[model samples]
Structure formats: C-alpha cells, structure tokens
Target chain A: MSAPPLPRTSAEPLVPVLAIVGVGLIGGSFAAAVRQSGLVTRIVGAGRQGGTLARAQALGLIDEIVSLQQAAQTADLILIAAPVGATTEILATLQPSLRPETIVTDAGSTKADVVTAARQVLGDQVGQFIPGHPIAGAEATGPEAADAQLFQGRSVVLTPLAENSNASKALLTRLWEACGARVVCMEPDTHDTVLASVSHVPHLLSSIYMWQVATAQDSDLRMALAGTGFRDFTRISAGSAEVWRDIFLSNRPAVLAELQEVKAALARAEQALIDGDGAALEDFLERAALARRLWGSRSGLA
Target chain B: MSAPPLPRTSAEPLVPVLAIVGVGLIGGSFAAAVRQSGLVTRIVGAGRQGGTLARAQALGLIDEIVSLQQAAQTADLILIAAPVGATTEILATLQPSLRPETIVTDAGSTKADVVTAARQVLGDQVGQFIPGHPIAGAEATGPEAADAQLFQGRSVVLTPLAENSNASKALLTRLWEACGARVVCMEPDTHDTVLASVSHVPHLLSSIYMWQVATAQDSDLRMALAGTGFRDFTRISAGSAEVWRDIFLSNRPAVLAELQEVKAALARAEQALIDGDGAALEDFLERAALARRLWGSRSGLA
Candidate 1:
C-alpha cells in the first residue's frame, strides 16, 4: 500500500498480471494489443458470458480465462472493460478479492457514474481505481471484431477521481501508452461534457437523421438511391444500441443541452431559407465551413 | 432547327463547337472532361470575368476563350455550369446568340429554377435546354481544381422539363455519358426533393453541428480532442460556402421540410434522454442503427 519498491533491474519488467473483464470489442482489443506488445507476462479475461470469454481465448486475445474473483486475486492490473451499466455490479463482485496494491481501471464511455460506483464499492481502495476511456471502436461489436490497432493514434482520456492514487494513475497511463494511445487527463465532468458534444451527441444525431430518412414515405426508393454521402452521414447510427442507450441515459442533461444548441442553429438555417435570404444562408454556411475546416486541419483529419 | 438530320455514319460525329460558361470548378471540369475525350472538335469558354476565361484556357480546360455572344453562336453544344443564382443572368446574355439547333443544358443543382429561367430567356428554344446536376465534387474549387475524371463513376441527374424533345434529352445524356457519368432522369421537383434529403440537409446538419462545437466553451480543447467521427460528420460542412448557400436558397422548401423532420427526431431523442427512458433510447438507437445498416448493406457501402 505504501510507495511501491522500484523494479530491481533497469530492464522493464513484464506486466505481472493483467485482467480484462467482459472481453468484447474494446476489452478484447485491449487484451490483443497488450498481448501483441509482449509486455504482459500473462493476460486473463473474465466475462459473465462463457461464450465471450471462450471466444476471447480462442482468438488468442488472452493467455487464460478465469472468474471475477480469480482475476482480482491474481491481477496486478484489473481492467473493468464492460458496458457502463454493468460496471457497478462487476465492481461489487471484484472488490472483496482485490489486493491493496492492485491497480484498477475501466474503459467505459461515461465516467461520472462509474467513478461514483468505484468510490461506493471500494471506499479507501478506490485510490487504486483509475477511471479511463479509450475513444476507439467500430460499428461491429463482439470479440470477433476486436483489433490490436483499434486504439492506434487515438486518445485514451483518464478521469482520475479525487481518491485515485498518483501511482495508480501513472500505471494506468503507462498501460494505455503501451496500447498505442495518447493519454489525456481531464476531470470526469469535463470528460462527460466534451464527450457529449463530440461522441455521444454525434451518435444520436446520426441515428435521428437516419431514422428520419428511413421513415420517409418512399424510403425504399431513397435507400436505393442513397450514395456515399448518405452512407457516411449515417454510418455512426449503426453503433451498438444498448451501449448508446446507456450513454444517453447517463449523460442526458449534457446531451439535451447540446441537441438544443444544434436545433437552434438548424432553426436559423430554416428561417433563412423561408425568408429567401441568400446572403444570410451564405454567411451561415461560410462560417460553419470555416469552423469545420479549422477543426479538420487542427485534428489532422482529411 | 425543325429536325436536325441524323448523321449518316455509324460512328457519332464530333461536336463541331462547344461552349462552356462560368469557368469555375464544375464548368472548368466539364470542359476538361469533354476535351480529354476528344469528342468535341473545338471548345470555347465564356465568363463575366475575363480572368476566368484566361485561367480556364491556361489550365487547358478549354481550347479558346470567346465572347459570350460568339461562343453561343458557334457552339453545337452549350453547357452552362454556373451557380444556380447566376443561371438566369447567364441565360439572358446567351439567348440572343443561341443558334436554333444548339443543344443547351446546365449543370446547376436546382432544376426547377433553371427550367424557369430557360422558359423566360429562351422561350421557344426552351426545348433545347436540359437541367442537369452532377453529384460529384471535391472540397476544392476554381478552374485549377478542375479534374477531367471528376464525373467518373458519379451519377449525373438530368431533369428535362415537360415537353422537352427526346432528341435533346438523348444528346445531353450522351454528352454526360461521354464525360464518364451514369445518367438518370427525374422530374425537376422530384430531383430537388431527393437532393434536399441526401445532400442539402446533410450539409446543413453538418454545418450546424460544427457551429455548435465551435461555440462551445472549451472549443479549442474539443477541437483538439475531435476524432474521425466528428471529422466525417462535418466533412460536407467544410465545402464551398457560396455553393452551399446557393443550394440552400434554391432548394429552400425541401431543405426546410427535411430540417423540420430531423428536428422532430432530435427532439424525441432529447425527451427520451431527459426522461431517463433507457428502453426508449435503446429502441431509437437500435432502429436507427438497423436502418442505416440495411441501407449500407443494400447500397454495397459496407
């Protein structure tokens, strides 16, 4: 529990034990990335569904599969990589077996609720819990869709709650770095707000937009004629429904505020069109285009 | 003028003269694409600004720069590729010199407006005017950005106003085909409505979304943290402001309708999130995701 002794030798010691719970796309990808790096001596995966755990091992994403208690007892690093809604129960189950020096982290999108759950379950042991989110995924779900390079060139934001220890935070940062992610530090609330604007709100907007198109009177014909523009605009709408549901629920206020802001902008555009104000429309489009170009250039995206 | 004699040869005869107006991206690209095919014996360009003609010829987008009257008098095929707002004025200038048998057409986004303009300016020669829109472009603009292959693998939608001559329609279709585009026919109103849904509305949404992000309190941080999701969502928002503004003005009604529908969907999502109705949120996301996947799968986008 005290400051951990430094490794005896200069050579980087292998990750003694890394446990990934709920080995789906994110978790499975995490295990795969770590295993491929050869930095971990052993990677163990635990999932409620036996099929998922079996599939993770079969895909060579993990060195072994174990129960929650077993993984907590053995792992120097415990990664709770499950759905946000499942985190509380998983934390409760693993708390009893967790050791004083064990470092725990999560890859959940919503952070405030998860941090609260960790504090409630582990109390003083919450110091070992470093909450993190890896902003990488695909339209596809399941362990079969996991890729070692999923996190490459992407960010993994860590929201270390007040109780989190510096040692635990540093170790978690190292793990994310080893997985080829750029680590960022942000408060949990800030993380939620930023994510609502960038990730969660975009997903919802895409879904809502697609729903509007799909429900059109001549949807079949429209879908038939839909090309690259429509395809890309609605691509994120195809993300996992359950995961998004939990995210929207957890981050409702921020999401709603963001949506209202977008709606106001849309209203202004609609009003300009109704008024036949070409100059106003032009100005709006020009401003928006300039902002988007600036964002794209800054983000290093085409 | 009554009935142009069909060429008596198996091979299609080269177009003796071609006139391209505007000399911007679309106009210049059309000239380049036509010249590259060697289907036209001579290509002439006309624009309000002399510099555009010089730039078009300098960039090899056309063989020669000519006066609007001269280009109109000499050309067998006259292609207008100016912004929708300029179509009316361009038609007025070219009408006095339009040869009786000239096959005239436009590459404007809005067909109904162009058709209206043709009816006013060309009168009896309205039959010679075909309204077309090429559904292909890059973010870049100007004559220098013109590409001969811009229309390759892209759809060129033609709206031949009621009572258009079959011969005129056939000639325009052939011209687009020669330029490497698949041509499709639709009513002017239908074309406008479909484009509003697939193109105009998406642009508005993307722009509005980007505007919202730009106005956020932590705009810089959010921009720095933005990933591919935000990039793709806002891709169209980064296009030419003037062009998009004209599109919004020209297709005002349809864009407004689509915006209203999207707003309703966003409102529903907002309500669901506010209520913390996880089931409703999941259902909305699931249906949207399913619809998108179905559309993507059918369109071969996946």
Candidate 2:
C-alpha cells in the first residue's frame, strides 16, 4: 500500500497547499488522486471529528490533519467534499481566512444548495467557488473505501457561476481530467434536475423496493433467493444513509417529479394487468425496453 | 458449435425427451441445458417461425426442429418457453398428441397467466402441467445468445398446480437442477406477486426513466454522459421489448400495486424537494438506503 508506483510523471506545477474538508470517501479519494497524480506538493485534510482526519492522514489520504481555520488559511484550494447539508457550516468556518486567490470548490451531489451556501458565507467572493460534483463513488464509505481510481472513466459536472474566473474553472476542469474524469459544464439547476432523475430517484426506488422485500413475511426465503437482478437493482440502496438522506432532502423536487412519472407508467401497466390487456402491457414494456436499449447502446453501456 | 461439449455423463437414464417450444434465448438455453446435463435423450424444438428453428438447429441449441404435433407426440416433457400470450395456443396445438406421462412446464415470467392459459387448453390434463420460471437471462436474444450455463447459480421458481403429481414435480425439479439451477417452490399467486415487486416493477420503472431521458431535449448529451449508475438502473430496460410487454400484461395487477406504492414514495420525495425539505429528503434516502443495504447484504450482493 506504499503508494502503488506512480502511473505518470509529475510534470504539472505543484499545488503548494491543498485542503480537503470532511475527508471521507470523496475527500479521501480526491486526496489520494492528487497524491497519485503527483500534482500537489502538500495536502491537509480537516474533519469535524479529529478521528476521521487522523485516519485519513494515517492511511496516506492526506499528509497533514489540521483545523478548518488553519487549512483554510494556508491552502491554495479548499475542497469541500462533505455531505451537502454540511457545506454551509464548513463554508462559514472557512470564510474569515478565505484568500482572494484560493479556489473553493465542492464535490457535493446537489449544486444549487452548495452554491447558495457559498454565496451566503462568502458573498461576491463566491466567484472563487466552483460548484462541481464528481459522478463517481462506491456503495462503501470512509477513507478506507477511497480509491485513487474512483473517478476514472466517470463524468464530473461543473456548475460555474458567471463571476468565476476562467483560470479557476480551467484549473478545476484540468484537475478533474487529471483524475481521469470527463468534465461537462452544466447549469446548477439543470444539473440538480438531471442528477435527481438519473441518480437520487433511482436510489430512493431501490431503497423502497428493498424495504418492501424486507417487510415481507418470508423475508429470509426472499432474501436467500435474491440474486444478481435484485443486487443490481438495489446497489444504490447500499449508499450511506445519512449522506443519501441529506441528498434526498436537498433535491426532493426533481426526485419527486421523476417518481411521479414512473408511477403513472406503473399504474398504466397495472390497469392492463387487471383488465387482462396483454397488448397494452406489451406496448408499455416495449416502449420502456426500446428507450433503455437506445440509451444504453448510445452510452456504450450495452 | 458441435453441440458445445455436453457437461454431464451420458450414462444417466430414463433421460427425458424435452420438447422446447420456442428455441430462442429461453428455449434454446433450455435445449442446451438439457444437452449439457445429459438429462434428456433428445431436445426437439418447435417454432412456428422457420428462421428460429434453423438457427436453433445450426447453433446445436436443439437436436431437431419438429412440428408441434410431432414434438408433443414423442416428448416426455413439453416446455412451453414461448411468449405468455402464445402459450395457450401452443398448448392447444400440442394437447391432441400429449401423452399421459408428459410433464409440461414453462419459462414464462408470470405464472398465474400461464397456469390459467394451461387450464383453458389442457382441462383435466392441467394436472400434468408445472408452471416454472428460471430467473435467468441476458439482454441478448435468440438461439445464438443461448448458453447452457445461463441457469447456473440462478433460481428457478416452480409453481406446481394442486393436481400435479409428486413424481412430475420431482422430475421438473431435477431437470432444473440438472440445468444448474437452485429450485424454489411457491404458490403461483405468491410467485407472481413476489416477481412483480422485485422484477416486473423495476423493469417498468427503468423504462419510464429511460423514456424521460430519451425524450429529453438534450438526449444525446444525457445519453453520452450516462454512466454505470444509469446503465445499472436501466439494464433490464434493454431486454426484449416483446417478451417484457407480455410479462407486464400477464402480471399487471401485482405490478400495478407495486407501482402504486413506489409512486407514492416517489411523490413524497417530489413534495419534499418542492418544499425544500432537506431533512425529509435525507430521511427518505436514508431509510431506502438502509433497507436496500440490509436486503442486499443478506442476499450476499454487498
């Protein structure tokens, strides 16, 4: 584990002081990725509880464990990789020491909320903040689960405010690319809506389905019979409850809209079943299958 | 493919004669499984379409492609692996030549429909029919996609009618086991309900979600950005539209009921999002995640 031999040369200018807030899976991963890339000269991580910081540093996820104020004061980039709900307080803590040149970005799921929180804490200086979400993670959590390769082949969505400097945006984009992510620029609200449909709502659906199965009278038998299909359908349900709960709350509207649309489709199929409308049910299934096939084929997922 | 080298000993006897009635993915796989298990002396396939029969024979998916009457006349087991809607008609065509010892089963997704269809066509001889579903398949279709190992490590749910003999039940169970499936017994209604909740509803939800995305203004962009999360969530949507449509129709009530429940949950999430209730959203996501994690872990998926 002594740093799997560097995969690439360290040609880029060294990031002198890098601060990662809430060093769990995402934060830890960012730290590891920076280390792997050989682009950061020094990395410091700040966590609410000292234990996480200690563990992160011990695991080589960070070079130093420091206070939020200390990390904020010295770091070139202060990355808020905490749960969406925790961003506001973390931003507040970093405000006094916020340097004009310090690029503040986040790896939160929801963008608008993080942007709003940054605006409230740092006002016009929010221009230094780039609201970004790296669409990558495992069902597992904590620094132990962090892998430098987590973001590889993944997409990172960046929501840059109008006032954000081109240099800041370019740097952040390059960093993500260096981490092996395909970067896409999106409007903050649009990103939330799209993500809710694609990620958050699906998580909720998986959880509800699992709950239904768990509550069944023959839960043990059902659980034993659960195979790859069930596993795949429920993978997202294994995500951190605390983090997901916050995400659901923060991005409820889009999730709900997507849920409603799915429900209507389900209801239509239900009516067909009750009425013994084989043709109608087939039609619905066909449409669904077609859409999925097209999307999957187009996405190189088929 | 020179019969793909049968996996079982040739010495095993009273080898059943299996008449596979579709010779596509399910039927072809069954034919291959029968050959691989050395549990069937002959795997004769009956398909109305000439191309399927040709492909099945050419791919060594079947020993012979026979007419429905001929297959029913000589086979010890009649596996109606055709579309659910076509099962009754196929049963009717095969009934005239069905022997008293012939054990008929199916690979239908929905049991209740197939059972009902069997009762209509076979009457008192319905006792000879055993409704079964192998919860195994890939997105790929046709004889070319059939694999003898498809059922390996998969579950095969059997719903024997009240009148079915223990001998027939045991034989059907053995056949599935020979195909490398772990067999489970359940009442037909219960099987339909369980599958609807776990499998059917998920497919419908995936399709609806895919439809939403596919129909979006930036569908290409969305599709391009689609990652493993979307791919997994919508995997079932890439399945055969015709086959899935029939399943939806056949098991509409249970699927609809499940859909209603999911819809309610999704609607709640939507309301929370609109109301900007981060706590509520978080709670929902956490609950879902916990349920999924518990089920997934218990199922050996996590």
DockQ scores for all predicted structures: 0.63, 0.45
User: What would the per-residue lDDT of candidate 2 be over residues B108-131, giving only the tens digit for each residue?
Assistant: 999988988889889989998999
For residues A124-200, write the lDDT of model 1, one tens digit per residue: 88888898899888888889999999988888999877777766776676667778988998888888888889988
Clashes of each: 0, 11
Q: Estimate each model's TM-score.
A: 0.92, 0.90
TM-score of chain B, candidate 1?
A: 0.90
C-alpha DockQ for predicted model 2 = 0.45
lDDT of 1 by residue, B160-225 (tens): 777678787776676677788888888888888888887788878888888878887788888767
Question: How close is chain A of candidate 2 to the true chain A, as a TM-score?
Answer: 0.92
**Candidate 2 on A159-276: residue-level lDDT in tens?**
9899888777877776787798888898988888888777886777777666666666766666666666667777777788778877877776676766676566556656667887
